[model samples]
Target chain A: MQPFTYERPADVAAALAAIGKPGAKFLGGGTNLLDLMKVDAETPQHLVDVSRLPLAQISDEEGGLRIGATVTNSDLAGDPRVRERYPVLSRAVLNGASGQLRNQATTGGNLLQRTRCYYFYDPSMPCNKRVPGSGCSALKGYNRIHAVLGASDACIAVHPSDMAVALAVLDAEVEVQSASGQRRIKIADFHRLPEAAPEKDTILGNGELITAVILPPAPPGGQIYRKVRDRASYDFALVSVAAVVETEGDRIRSARIAMGGVAHKPWRAFEAERRLAGAVLSDDAFAAAGEAAVKGAVGRGHNDFKIPLAARTVARALTDAAAQKKA
Target chain B: MRNTSVTRRGLFGGGAALGATLQSGSALAQSPPPGAGAPPVDVSLKVNGAQHELRLDPRTTLLDALREHLALTGTKKGCDHGQCGACTVLIDGIRKNSCLNLALSCDDLEITTIEGLGREEALHPVQTAFVEHDGFQCGFCTPGQICSAVGMLAELKRGLPSAVTPELAAAAMEVAETEVRERMSGNICRCAAYPNIVAAILDAAGKA
Candidate 1:
């Protein structure tokens, strides 16, 4: 890791001011940033330590919960309200990383975490995400973990976050603070595709600090998050699904779905949700919803298996959610 | 007895020598060389019930601070990344990978490493269980595994759920073998002593 100055600001205003310098980054939890620094992937000259800031609370909002940015993954997952109301989010948080990592990873840091693309981590390799316009090695190189949706010719790296997938389905909103003012971005518009700029992971402007994630009232349904990985634990997802299905007797009243490990961002299956609404709850209906989810999926050579895997994962998650007792 | 004495003296002498090198703040103390970067900063660390005031490069990780400066070698550096849990330590009663944490970021935090866990005569129950179960072969990842298990048991006692927990909304969870395995998945044992390690944790959990 490169030598850097560290500052623990007392407030958000100070944090924003401290990050105004060039090559400065907000250090929250330091799980991903510090790891990338050790490998020389991230070299910041100044680090504003925001982990100790007062942004660690989970407060009850109007009919919902507002999670502070620095809330550790463990705390978020263990929160009683989250487990009872947004069980899908709780499960998605637990399905990621392991006990130690979850304890150190913050909500904002997890959302801003870079792709785990093997090529991105290796400075020796040519990765467009690391250095834009340099070239994308994952396009033709080993890309078993690359994107199958919302991919562009510039890059195919997927957003390596399970929590974001759940948040997408929950219609969460991100509250961010900048030197100028504050703004709330819909979760769907928060993360961007790897169109021409893979280096820019999210729509977060420079020096914009994420303050909180506001989750709306839990949908009236059964929520489930199902992940398929190479291992049963501690591995990144190959394909994961976060689904909320509300059934009216034998028919589905509403449905919301989001997929991970298949796109540059948490791929919200809007089409699939549209198809499932008011449709009869059956295997054939669920299968069609799954098919609709991956309508425009384009799988690279090594990752062609992910397209079908993602579709099946969506179907399975919806099935499980439908079978579960509604909240 | 003579061999044990020699080994103990050698370990202490090596620790003293490393301590001298660190205290001097030579460029050698900063691995990979800072290359005209920020100066050293004062950091107060409370580790294993002892307070130490040290000046360290901002780039130094908690793992390096514990091992190189404080000479706490029990918290091994396996991958020097978060991938391996060899540097697992308890910060504010929560288990975290020390390798991924910046030493400066952990200033004034309560850090408990393996050495702080138990003494030779009065071993922690988890350590005792590991011994009885023969939970290790080469014993490289033992320190991290023990610390992680201790922290994990605390989490379990607090009703923290794991990925394998059948019901997310359950008020409480049982500490089954699957739960232990899933919870301890961060610590990688290259020796493949998982079966014995799982047995040890279960035994410790029962006793706890």
Candidate 2:
């Protein structure tokens, strides 16, 4: 951690002004920023504290659940309305981090948490995310938990939030406020792939503050979040599944599925969902959907197992979601 | 009685002097105080019922603040990274990773550490249960485990969902042993004393 100026702004306007400078960073939960600072991955000249601002509200506005970006992961998961209206989001939030981390981490910060690539955390090791174009050591060394989707020659780190996967499944939108104005970005576009510039993680501009996340209500049906990891707790996913299925009269009417621990952004299983729509969701349909989801998955030597594991995880998630209809 | 009073008075005087020096030395020296009021910045955190104002680099973590600055060294630093929950604490009644938290940002929040849970004569229920169950062996992760258990109980009381929860039903039920294990999974014990840890938490929750 380095010596830097700190300011606690009362509102969004002040916070934006505080971080409008070239080298300032917005401090939300400090779960990510403070950890990065310890190893010196992020050395901002100033820290704009947005925790105190009244940005921790979760309310039902016209659009859907208006989840204040600073709302803690614990609160978001525990909120009755969120659970009732959007269990996928709640399950996603709970699957991430741990009970302690979920308590302190903000929804906005969770989506923006840096890659868990061990090489990125160690400055001595070359990683394009930490120091762009320096090199990608995870490409070869200790690449088991690296990525199997959304890879470029420059980087192949997986986006690490379970909540982001659920958001992608629901087609949530992010509300960002900046010095200039406010804008809403689809959850998929909010996070970017490596794509030559692996350093740029989110579409958020230099001074933009994530205000809230707007969730479009889940269609009447079932939702499930399933994660496969080395440990049942506190570990990042090897492959995770977030699926919402609307079944009508023994057939799948509509489906939205996204994957985590396997891609750069929440890996939307669009092809898989397309295959399931209007088809009776039997064992064969789910297997085909799972296959479709991982059709283009390319894997490194250590992580080749993710291709099948992710497919199975997605298939199991759909089965689980469908079972909820009967329960 | 007179001999004991004399020793107690002497210790009090030394403690008071140390506290005063820690608070006042920085501004006069034009350099950051020995550990007090200098900048980068001086942060006053109300941790476990004590007010500690210390001069630190803006990036100093709350875990460092508790262990290094105030000497409430119960909170262990395992990974230093947020991946491990060894530095878990309760700020405003919610569990958080103190290593991933900045000391200055916690200025106005209520912080609870393992020290706050017990003394030589008395123990918090969680601490007592841990002892009874032999929940820990090396004892390195006890502080974080206890703090995390407290947070886990609160989450269950609030009806928070877990990955295993089939749905977000509002039904109030005993936090099952399996639920406790899944919820507290973040705090890893290399010793693999999880079965006892779960037993302790279940016993504590019954009392809580």
Candidate 3:
């Protein structure tokens, strides 16, 4: 790693101020930032260590749970309140990374984690997301794990977060702090679509620091998280589903559906949610919802498998949630 | 510092008494204190029971610092990318990939490596069980596997649930084979020694 200035601030306000400087980045758990530094992927001139800030707290609020941005994945998953009330959030976090990573990775950093696209990590490759106008290598290269939804002509990278998919399904809110002050953004809008600007990832402005994430109270009833992957663990999802449903008898009262490993962001299946909201839970309804979820999916040669896999995952998750409700 | 005086007196008397009783071929009782050159970069490390205050590079990783600087070579570095668990160690009782962690980050913390597992007369159950079950081939990833298992056991004891766990709110449940394999997925053994490793860990947990 190159020589750089390091600062350990005392509090969040000072830490935010220090990170607002030109070319300054906040160091949370250093899982991603430090790895990038070692390979010279991201070379920040200054590092503002925000690890000591008291932002690791998880508190119960009137509206919902306020998870400090610095809360480690392990702590969040292990929290009694989180597990008791928001099981989807806990399950999503547990499915990500590894034991060591879960202990070091913060909630904010997990959401802001870059895609695990191989080309993007290797600077020698021509990745438009890594370098603007450089062209996308995955377009013609190995794209088995690339995006099949909401992908642009310039980039086909998929977001590598399972927790973000759950958050999107839970309708969470992200609180950000900057020089101007604090702002709240809905989880669905936090991640940007890779349209013309594939390089830009999040909605946060430059010099903005993620302060906390507020998970609004979950809707009544059953929730299920199912992630399909090549390996059992410590690997990114091939296709994952976060589904929560409320039903009266066999009729669905309401439903929220989101997908991962198939899009640049947590791809919310708004149409699927609409299809299942007032419909009855059955094989026909599940098939229809799955079809609606991938109605606009455009698959590449290497990622064509994801279309069927994602649709199947949505269907399986819905079936499992219905079974859980029956029990 | 005053305790040094009594310790020096005791050392002198003991040295004189054992001088003739020891074998002539044996080397000196004291190894030369590492050449007093510029105070070895003043790194204070409390690894296991011993405390080391040495000088070293600022960029050294904890894995390198343990294997090279301190000569505690029990920790092994596999991929060095934090992907392989062959360099796992406990910093303040929390398992971490030593290869990816900087030594400077562990200034005031307690570090426990494989060397701290057991002595010649007594073996930590995990270490003894690994030997009995043939839980290694090249043995490169064994140290990390054992260390990570130690941390994993601690997590389970605290009622921390895994993704595969059916119920997140349950406590003190049996650790099934599938759950163990899933929890230990972070460590990779090239020799395909996972079956024996899981057996050894299960045996140790049963004993505990």
Compute each candidate's TM-score over C-alphas. Answer: 0.94, 0.90, 0.89
Task: For candidate 1, write residues A52-93 as lDDT tens digits.
Answer: 889999999989999999999999999999999999999999
Model 1 per-residue lDDT tens digits across residues B52-97: 8888878878998898688798999899878889999999889999
Q: State the lDDT of candidate 3 residue by residue for A1-327, as single tens digits.
A: 444556678788898779877778887777777776665556676778786688999988866899999999999999988887778889998999889778778999888888888888776678788788999999999999999989998999999999899999999999998888889999999999888788888888987889899988766878888999998899899999998888898798888889999999999999899989889879889878888899889888988999988998999888877767432
Which run of 10 residues does model 2 chain A get worst, by summed lDDT?
Answer: A318-327
CAPRI-wise, candidate 3 is incorrect
Which numbered prediction scores highest in DockQ against the true structure?
Answer: 1
> What lDDT does each candidate get?
0.91, 0.83, 0.82
Candidate 1 has an lDDT of 0.91
- The residue pairs found clashing in candidate 3 are B40-B55, B41-B55
Return the lDDT, model 2, position A91: 81
The parts of candidate 1 lying over 4 Å away from their true place are B1-36
Alpha-carbon lDDT of model 2: 0.83
Candidate 3 ranges with C-alpha deviation above 4 Å:
B1-44, B49-59
